[model samples]
Target chain A: MSEIIVNAVSKTWGGVGGVDRISFKAEAGTLLVLLGPSGCGKSTTLRLIAGLEEVDSGTITIGGRDVTHLSPAERRISMVFQSYALFPHLNVAENIIFGLKVRGVGRAERDEKLRKVADIVGLSHLLERKPSQLSGGQRQRVALGRAIIAEAAVCLMDEPLSNLDAKLRHEMRTEIRALQQRLGMTMVYVTHDQSEAMTMADRVILMRDGHIEQNGAPHELYNEPASDFAARFIGTPPMNIISWQDGAMLGVRPEHIFVAERNGVPATVRAVEYLGADSIILCDVKGETVSVRQTGYCSLPAGTQVGLEWQNRHIHLFDRDSGKRLADRAPA
Target chain B: MVAAVMTAAEPKTARHRNWATNVNAWLLLLPAIVLLGMFTHYPILATLYHSFFSLGRSGPAEFVGLENYRYMLDDDVFWQVLRNNFIFALATVPTSIGLALLMAVWVDKKIVGRSFLRLAFFTPTVLPMIAVANIWLFFYTPDYGLLDQFLKSLGFAGHNWLGDPSTVMTCLAVMVVWKEAGFFMIFYLAALQSIPPELKEAASVEGASRWYFFRRVTFPLLMPTTLFISINALINSFKLVDQLVIMTKGGPNNASSLLLYYIYEVAFNFWDTTYAATLTVTLITILAAVALTKFVYLDRRIHYQ
Candidate 1:
């Protein structure tokens, strides 16, 4: 098994910002995304797994081998940095085959592998160009080519697509997912963008302040968030959380709540955001801001009174103080 | 009619404005141009003009084309000094540069006492060359010098370091390298720090050994700084002669005399002003050629960020 098991790993610098006792297992051939905001220790966790940073406590195993104390070279892994980190002086082909040359691969084998990897990454025509000569997307492709050329079983990516524009990011996202599936490489991708995690990951591990808030498949995190933090972190226009009675919070996805004619929680429409395929109607309910996602256009103007309603099955209850999800659903 | 007249007059006003802009630009450039021409360009031209003429000792100077040049070709001392300069350059340039790069790489690490190490390496560069020469002079003194004392303690015979002809050039070369390497280290240190840490991380993840990564990535990336430092070091090898005045004085039969010191001797001591101009012309030609080769050839070969 080429799975990566990070067992209770903790790394902190000078009693400051770092991951704390975070543990997760990335199965072989699956893309596990470490998703969080900045300074949430997502990148640090990836670095620890790559052996770039040592775990202060606990054991890290890659393919069932204890590799916590091993050098990065002995760990048998590859990583793509957010900056791409292509050697500026080397041409694309040289950069891609640098690792092969370091490992003493012969010229013939190096050239053959270079050609294959170049073709795979769609950089055959641009082999001789330096990184300064390539576009951002092309540089990213070179970085990708370099990472995959080693054919390491576990590949770690730290916000690799964060440098690209929106459209290119989406394109590279799908391409990377497809490539990971094709190569059967266990990938631990880190990203701050929740949409990237929701779309690309086989499993999503949401982190908050160095602790794992939730860990499950993407749909599972979206549908059944274990805490209010996970519920708010998963979806776009994320799950609507509002103050409820008796020191509890009521959580419902924006898609679950709808405008009703009568006999629902009364709210005032504060504003409307009209996206092309859908719209988000922002409403004020008892001095708390909650958004409701609707299909197509939401033509409700500001200051209009509306009643929001959802089914009892869609209601989620959490303790206000702890933010932990309560097992029992609210009354209908 | 008025419109046509205005159109015809527009060109004249535009020309006037252009003339004013040109004058403004020239005014802004006037100080630098005047200073360089007076101090640098004029001296070089005067040297070249004087090189072809005879020194007027008892009468007016007369045109003596190629006389000094022929005499310089026949001068054994001049030939020896020229050869000595080449050897000195060859000895000091590469050694100093290599040591500088080594020191820079060492101090750039997160080792213990890194700041202290950096300061220690840089201390030599801050000392004036005359003071440095004096310190080295004390060390190279014949019998009771530090070097001799150490050698005597080792049961070896104390020998002349700077006084002997055989060891004079080597001694001078060693002193020059020691004095020069620390300055060049600053450049290499800056270049090393500018390299993004992510590149090292990426290389490490690819199973690259530290030495392998340095050979392939770090070294190639530092090529521009290396070229710059080498050219400066080469020029300095020819130019710097203050230390020779203090320690060797081109002594014991001009064995350690560089071309510049020989030129100083010919110009000031021997009073051969025209011949001195000829030597100066040759020195300028060599320096100009070195600078030109860097600009015309090496700059293209190096990779600048």
Candidate 2:
């Protein structure tokens, strides 16, 4: 079942705008992530779904009912915020139980649900502690517990792991993913970290300037980025884009290029980054710096002459004037 | 030893430079020194000297150690006045803080004709408290006041406002709330401005309705600000006695008499100089206690990220 349907939804601020007529869906129990840079409208689109912001146009359906004008309490959806938004005055149990209490859920049912959620998120030992007393990771779990106990059809998380340090973020991301699968809850997560988006999401909706550039499975987005923007945004250190003259927007993944000792190909090493697993060779092809992932080729000094080689079919081409990906390159 | 001492000294010119740095530092603190001595130290010393002594008729004051303090503890009127002051502080602090918060939320919403409405709420704060008292005095008049006229028109019997003992304090409370709520609202407004908008939006998305959001999230966050405003309202309640003077004169037989106004009467009206000195000491003590709480809280309240 499609638990959420955002149909032509758009929101524009008074001066600068956010999401522009974005439409997408999340199948029940599937995780859909709105991935983009900061100020790229990923969070705004999430806010629109949560009913925090009114859309300037379009309708949203949850559980097959039009809920565009409905208030948040009326919508059977729960959201976990980036800051966790834990009530400082309320202990963990109180915070998780707040929404249910407000909705008149009976004490026993609420308690049982709270226990289940706490157990799932591993927060049973810290029920009496306030948000201030909890560390960042603990707070994140409490926030998840808060949403989980609601038992809403869908859960929306807006950059919930950004506040944690890098190590904690990785651990919590895996924990959240496991918990989601165990519960089979429909989730829409927003984040800018490409790695987190790649690892945590079943489907990633890559956005640029308030519009969805491409959306697909993580590997699909990686192997088949629809535009230069998607290619550059989807990978670590991003895909190496070289400015080539004469109607070519050349891009290659750092690992895709090899410094083979082959003839009739042109390149020169400009700068070398000695990464233990893979060296990043910054080569000057004419005047452009081309970053190539030198796998098992670490300790290569700068100014080392190397021939650039690649499979022609794997090379991507784009229309330089429009920045649109050209599926078939013009004959070389 | 001489070489070691010379190294420690650096040079005579270096010592001169150190002296110059000291002087520059003092110069930077000059304004604070003058203001502190003028506003705090001198008055405290003068009050301390007066509190111990009995005033003689047209001569040098007599030093009767703790005599005024003992007299204060025994005076029936002084006790009554102190009780009334405490009641006033309790009544006004809560009412003012609550009303101020309501007004801040109302104005922050930018309701219809928002600028005009904001201006209306804040106008009372700009007008002098004495002037506000005068306005309320007319409103509270028994026969010809607008309130009495409105009551009669609505088929209800009109009654005295400040004239009635049961309602006099309530009248003062209402008047003070009207005068002070907007001022406190400005503080709340500043606090409200500093709250991240993301926090509220997050709440909205959490399936919590407006009231639930405020109760769970916003109210707890605004705790430190509420404490701040409570302290301000407490101090202002003791400081404002102009209404008692102009509207009630602490009368219909001293029903509305406050600690500060009563002190003024004892010192100046009765020429019971010794008794007045005693009253002044009490007033200073009460004010000092409130000021000390404010000082401590303000110094340590800020929590940085």
Which of the numbered candidates is closest to the native, going by highest TM-score? Answer: 1
Residue-level lDDT tens digits of model 2 in B252-303: 6667788888888887788776677677777777878887976786546533
lDDT of each: 0.94, 0.83
- N/CA/C clash count, model 1: 0
Q: B157-257 in candidate 1: lDDT tens per residue? A: 99899889999999999999999999999999999999999999988887888898899899999999999999999999999999999998998799999
Best by DockQ: 1
By summed lDDT, the worst window of 10 consecutive residues in model 1 chain B runs over B5-14
Error of 1 at A48 (Å): 1.2
| Full-model lDDT, candidate 1 | 0.94
State how far residue A54 of model 2 sits from its true place (Å).
2.5
Q: Which residue runs of candidate 2 sit more than 4 Å off their true CA positions?
A: A14-16, A108-111, A241-248, A262-264, A328-331, B1-52, B58-76, B83-87, B134-172, B244-248, B285-305
Q: Write the per-residue lDDT of candidate 2 for residues A11-116, one digit (tens) a residue.
A: 8888486888889888888899999989999999988888888889999998798989998767778889888877666789998888787778899998899888
